[model samples]
Target: MNLQKFSLEQLASFVQGKAVGQTEMQLDGLASLTQADAHKLAFVNADKYLDQANQSKAGALIVTEELRAHITSQQNFIVVENPYLAFAILTHVFEKKHTAQGIEATAQIHASAIISDTAYIGHYAVIGEHCVVGDETVIQSHCHIDDGVEIGKQCFIDSHVVLTGHCKLGNRVRIHANTVIGGEGFGFAPYKGKWHRIAQLGSVLIGNDVRIGSNCSIDRGALDDTIIEDGVILDNLVQIAHNVKVGANTAMAAKCGVAGSTTIGKNCIFAGAVGVVGHINIADNVTVTGMSMVTKSISEAGSYSSGTPMLESLHWKRAAVRFKQLADAPLTQMLKRLDHMQAQIESLESTFKLRK
Candidate 1:
């Protein structure tokens, strides 16, 4: 018998679902429709996957009400308004729980730092001066919490992560490994043919429930604080530069780079490798397609894309020439040419009418 097995009623309550037919059936874990066994639970979020659900040998399924009728065979499933969301919620139930309490020996803690008794500081993790670590927060192995930093309750800072320059994080924040918050921004001024470095004076302020992925960099601001609002999720290898204010609940995919001083609005989705230029504003509810470049401000909420699609080598070479042609013709020149063509068409129409 699987140690992690869950009864149908027990799993239904976790997602506020209605269990049907097999209330006594036990599911050991969650799996995809194509791979689930009789002891595993599966989900069908749409009608297209109904065939997969029908053939699956799973003990039960999680599905929406509308798709239930599409199954050819009798199925014991949990009915929910959103099967995908229920799947996401149930994933935590099967996740491996790591429980740790009390600071480990060989960890360095400054006397001025205030750490809650319930917090866990793992082996060799460094807690710097005047830092406040809240209750039930876990600072894993070799992590560094520098001077004047504050992390709120239930926050998890993973191994080898760095929180420096007095940065402050709100409750329930999760910072993955190899991530560096409050690093210096790329700020330099040209003086006598040499670049003079400008010190980053402000730290980063991350709000509650923010999840930062591994190997990501969130830079400190040049003068004002870099603000990441509540519920923003950044994928791995993403870069947030100086003085940027990322609005609430925005999701940035991997390799997306936002330049300095730009303000991103709430609920915007940046697909993978999308590059946003500095000093521009992106409106709320905007979705930029993958590999697109955002150079101007987005005022209206809509989907936007840039760059040409992939082509064969020779065809791309010809397309590149056409792009160069448009680039050589400035916007003002194009507008003037359009006006001239319109006048010529009107003149030709007038001449034809007189001749007729």
Candidate 2:
């Protein structure tokens, strides 16, 4: 792919940075300091990267004002308050080249469904009956969109993503590869030595600006709707059970398991590998640290953690022995002290009465 060139002056204004060197220099694309060619632009965000930035071959460099002295190559520079953020913005500009464009002939689109002409449907993608796909939405190869599913504008459904029947997605929602939406929840009843599955009647309703990572499974509710509110981000390998409600703007990291019927509040964050038990309510803005095992309801909006660290074998053995003896030691000491005090009081009282 041919690199798109942007003037240094235009880039500085786009990222809200200050230009120090030649503003007319053209930058082809974004690159790391070590990998940037003469036509590319690189950035240095920290002091540790100063050495690499100084020797970089890029046409222009984006860096903080404090690191201006490290630029020894007389190259163009875009000084900003936050170089890391500026670099991120520029990287996004370059990554747009990978976006899909036109629909493929092999795609199987339902005649009853409404798909915008601007949308791209990749090879072997299936859009079911009564489904609606908005403008500029891209359904990648091998994707399965079930009947009654509604996908909003500008959404990107990656390869192998399965959107089950009646799933609704809002605008700008991005689902990574192999993620399953609207799967049946683990609801079963044991009767007469055999297990009977409860019908999952509800569908998944996802809000706008949501990003679901790869291999995540979000189960539909058993009765009511399973809702993921706006701006929620879910990491890879996470399992959101049936009837669980995730509030708006909440971000959950990888491998987090939220059990059935749990109501997670708005803006809550769960670190990687956190386990939340079923039927609990978590208040808004709650933050759970990594590897925490949440067994009860959390009403407060703060960080919580639970897990014991490993200890040396000898020290742990000694601590265990003391812990076991703690209850008996206090009782034995209290009885002996009580007897001595009673004897002293009796002797004093008897002597005083006889003297009187």
Which has the greatest lDDT? 1
Report, for every candidate in turn, its global Cα lDDT versus the true structure: 0.93, 0.91
lDDT by residue (tens digit), candidate 2, 1-356: 67677889989988988876788888778889999988888889889988888788888888877788866775588989998899988887777644557779998988999989888899999989999999899999999999999999999999999999498999999999999999999999999999999999998999999999999999999998889999999999999999999999999999999999999999999999999999999999999999999999999999998875567998888877886786687877998899999999999999999999
Worst 10 residues of 2 by lDDT: 94-103
What TM-score does prediction 2 earn?
Answer: 0.83
State model 1's lDDT.
Answer: 0.93
Model 1 agreement with the true structure over 95-129: per-residue lDDT tens digits: 87668789899899999999999999999999999
Candidate 1 TM-score, true structure as reference: 0.93
Per-candidate TM equals 0.93, 0.83
Segments in model 1 whose C-alpha atoms lie over 4 Å from true places: 327-338, 344-356
Q: Give the distance in Å from residue 48's predicted Cα in candidate 2 to where it truly belongs.
A: 4.4
The positional error of residue 238 in candidate 2, measured at the CA in angstroms, is 1.4
- Candidate 1's displacement at residue 204, Å, is 0.5
